[model samples]
Target: MIDATRPSAPPRRILVVDDDAGMRDSLEDLLSAAGWTVTTFGRAATALAKLPEVNPDVVLADVRMPGMSGLELLRELAKPEMPPVVLISAHGDIPMAVTAVQEGAYSFVEKPYEPHRLLSIVQHAADQFRMAADTKRLRARLASLSGLDRVLLGQTEEIRTLRQDVLDLAESEAPVLLVGETGTGKELVARALHDLGARPGGPFVAINCATLEQDRFEMEMFGAKDGPRGFLGEADRGSLFLDEICSCPERVQAKLLRAIETGTFNPVGADSGASSDFRLISASNLEPEKAVREGLLRADVFYRINTFVLRLPPLRQRLEDLPLLYSHFLDEFAAVYEIEPPQTSHEDMAALLAHDWPGNVRELRHVAERHVLAARRGRGSAAEAMSNDQQRSEFPGTLREAVAAFEREMVGRAIRAHSGRMDAAAEALGIGRRTLNEKIVKLGLDKDNWL
Candidate 1:
């Protein structure tokens, strides 16, 4: 068995074949320096005879040999139980090396190679092999948990379509862009994509572009010289979700574009680039086109991400799903608070549905959690009474009456603060002077008798 902990196993029992004794010693020495257990053979047959006993991780054989050419030796070790074989050849034997790799050889190295180059390739291959094993184990674990129980609550046609779109995109390798109001569960959509994707075994790395400083955003997304893996690298062989992508600076967007195009990037001060394989998913509350027009987002970057788009309908547009979402949040909070779920009165539901949820689902969830916790402590009825009283105090009996009352209060305050200067009041209230004049006239605020 290979000593897995070894910095490098001499390919476990590398079989290096060469007619020249000096060349064999050179190869063995080089591999040994890299922590590989080197076994040199003067002839290919000798190496073949010891293959079963050696159980090598890799076999390095010269393409041109005296008896039993490297091709022939490769054929013998090509069995399913055999380890990967790397063929070494001279400059003029390029064709043979190409053929070797094409025929299932792990890789080929030319003579007089740089030691670092060879080691890098070998390390990459080893890492890939290890990742393959890890992916298999992860798939089994994920398969057990793959079910609809994890699906977020919503059954409206719009939500059903969004869920279906998420499911479809998860199975593909295309980039996804989610556009919605804040708190509409963009991250949830990204996660659903990951769960449905092929590389579910890998990590789900997320970065909020809006949260990072403009100067530090690039390093945060791509990584700094000595910091933790950047969002891109962290999600290697996994999924990366960039939230509020429109907020990323132009420089950061350029770097992200390169990474997406080439599947490679470097740390802030790194001298060399590192390759990564990650699926990209981005979300933004602002419209990308409008952002580009406003010079907040780059147009080129927008095109790259305009691929598969998923738009989450705001709470107002999906009012039909409110009852289901409300129940889900209530149940969740009930579980957390260790209390019986509070029932929503018909009037309560009507009020909730009527209000424009400026904060979207997040606001609803917060309200539900508060209610559940309050109910657990027997303050639920008091909280409801207070809320009702507050609403009654602020709101009129009818919509038209409510609008008139709100308008009168706002106009009265503006007029008083500006000392009745309509122009100044208009400017202060962010309305055109003409609009303010009309409002004053329509509300009869200009009546001298009232003044």
Candidate 2:
């Protein structure tokens, strides 16, 4: 029986395999000197047999041997939970050693190896193994936390059913089409799907299709010579989320179709093609089938993405979630401002619920931020501010004019409340002090008469 309390042993078990008895002894001496529990086997088959008993942390195997070559030993140990294998080879065996690494060997060390180099490789392999294990544990924990029970935030039957669908689709790699209006949290659902899936460690890349100009759409999606690699390449081995999929131009749609089918794309101006192994999740405010019928989207592309559709209910449809979402946003903004969350009166909730939220959750978020800022500036309560909106009946001439008027009013209020303290006013408005000063100068609010 191996003594578990041996002082000369390494911190973990290390198996050394070499055909030559002298080489095996030398390796064992070096590894043992470095405080490892070293085990030596002259034959690769013997080492393979001992592996089940020892459960070594790392295997340092000589590539060329009499029987059961290092490559063969590596293949046998490729089973799950097996320790990482490091290949040792001669100068002439560099090509084979490279092949070994490609076949899942942790690393390759050329022989006759320097003791320090061998020790470095062993330490690195052990650390990488530990990191991989830790990441797996973290992913499992995240998945458990983000389970179906936790994902669906509301108790409504619609939300409950949607949550179940999300859970079911989380296990699949098929493309998902999330149809929702702007600010409906489509990206949030996409992330949940990726996290709950098998390849949680893979990257998640999102592209807002509506934000890209029509002429630049192809280069942005497929990558350009002067620009960084596009979203598709960036999301290799993970997921790519295309927001506002209907806005993807006809030319770009053609490239996307080819990429989805072949898992390959040639970067703009690149001669060679690169392959990506990733899942697709796309979102759009417009109905994809309707868009295809209108000729705004390709029929084939629509069919390809319509495999699994998840329609997010608009805020108006799910008014029950308003109170919870409102309170959540209140707490979020309050924490950022370092102020206690403002109290919401029952009348305020009623008014908020009654109003038609054309801007959806994004509008609600801004309203909450504005309310918090107003409350901080001694503007009574958020509800009182809403009641005052009825006093301003005359609408501004233009949209830009209306926005500027609202900005002036808010800035004026902040300035008066803070006794002309621009810094405090800027903080309340969530704008930089310099920016507030620039606006004040531009809008002719620098005079005391404005205050």
Candidate 3:
């Protein structure tokens, strides 16, 4: 089995800086024979000047030198694009070699170089350097991309088709029903429909039926007595997005169907409420047909909202997008926290691609967030950290535990994404205000940590 812990790729290139003509020649001959492309320099200044052209994966320089010693050269190359530098030193220069290593030097080699050990160190250093370089490239690509290409990112056919559908459907006011499994970005698609639709300037009122208590469903959807208008009223001349529509009570679903048919709703304590001229958008984690068959949704209501159904592909269905999405999330979170983006090894990426990602994009997002935190702490590979999380999420001992675990993740993500604002997070998550507060206490979700 591949260890998947250490890098597997052979060293590609090295930059050798040594004053002695004989030493540089010997090192070049040795590394070249071992499948490495080598570039040598007699002075650190010359090597530093031509660093861009060289672009070596790793650097080998002698610690003791006349001017601009290897230690000084290491400091000069300490910028973001700097490759790993391994300092070659004699026994007497070991102290300086230690300091150089502490100051970002990859490693040190004593005067009598053991060829195998030197090669091993160089290989690891190049791996680290290449990893960082890859992250920079991903960031550059992400920054260059624009519009929906940036928002709904992926090169897969599924994603490409989905983006096209979003654009096509956005031009119309026809009711759109987004059907997909959880974590498949149904709400995102709903928002995109409204944002690109004709009434983009109008209000976008979203409601989550699953989070609304049965008793208050009518008041919440219609209007409260002697209070502000409900979500229906708020969505006048705009878009109203209903998430988890199948979760609403059957009686309310009938009224909702009427409201859609009449384009108006009556408020509690008011003889007549202002007419609502809003385009309806609905989403369900379950398939519309399945929800209707299971009696969770009204057949008439489902048929009405299914004027143009858009299905979101799950993460597993578009496995090719994992690397791109993972790197993109890393860049996003890093930028949010004002930190440098982290990189993953080929092995780590392979492990990620192999996983089924049952939680879909949401699961991947959480994993990316974890890797960013790991990078901030200067920790090891992300794959190791993900093992425990995978076990907890993928193989729970009980159904109740599994449900609780998922709620914690979802609620916590909502809070964090909304910067710890309960109202905002509740709205985003489709959880009721009181339910969200109760969830915070029961689940021990701290707003401070999310903030």
Q: Write the per-residue lDDT of candidate 3 for residues 1-451, one digit (tens) a residue.
A: 7798988765598999999999999999999998998999999999999999988999899988878998899999877678888999774375776798789887888888999999899989998888888766753443343145444689988788888788778788889988776778777677777777788789989887777766888889988668878989899989999988877777788888889999877787787655799999998776668557546678999889999988888888888888898889889888987789887899889889888876788878887888887788887555865675776667778987788778888998898898777789889988776567545544434456667
Clashes of each: 2, 3, 0
Candidate 1 Cα lDDT to native? 0.74
Off by over 4 Å in 3: 1-151, 391-451
What is the RMSD, in Å, between candidate 3 and the native fold over all Cα? 22.6
The pairs that clash in candidate 2 are 10-35, 10-36, 10-37
193-264 in candidate 2: lDDT tens per residue?
998887789998988775666566677777867677888888899999998777676677888999998999
RMSD of 1: 16.6
**Model 1 stretches astray by more than 4 angstroms:** 1-152, 381-451
Alpha-carbon local distance difference test for all models: 0.74, 0.78, 0.81
Superposed Cα deviation of residue 138, candidate 3 (Å): 25
Which model scores highest in lDDT? 3
Stretches > 4 Å off in candidate 2: 1-152, 225-227, 383-451
Against the hidden true structure, what lDDT does model 3 obtain? 0.81
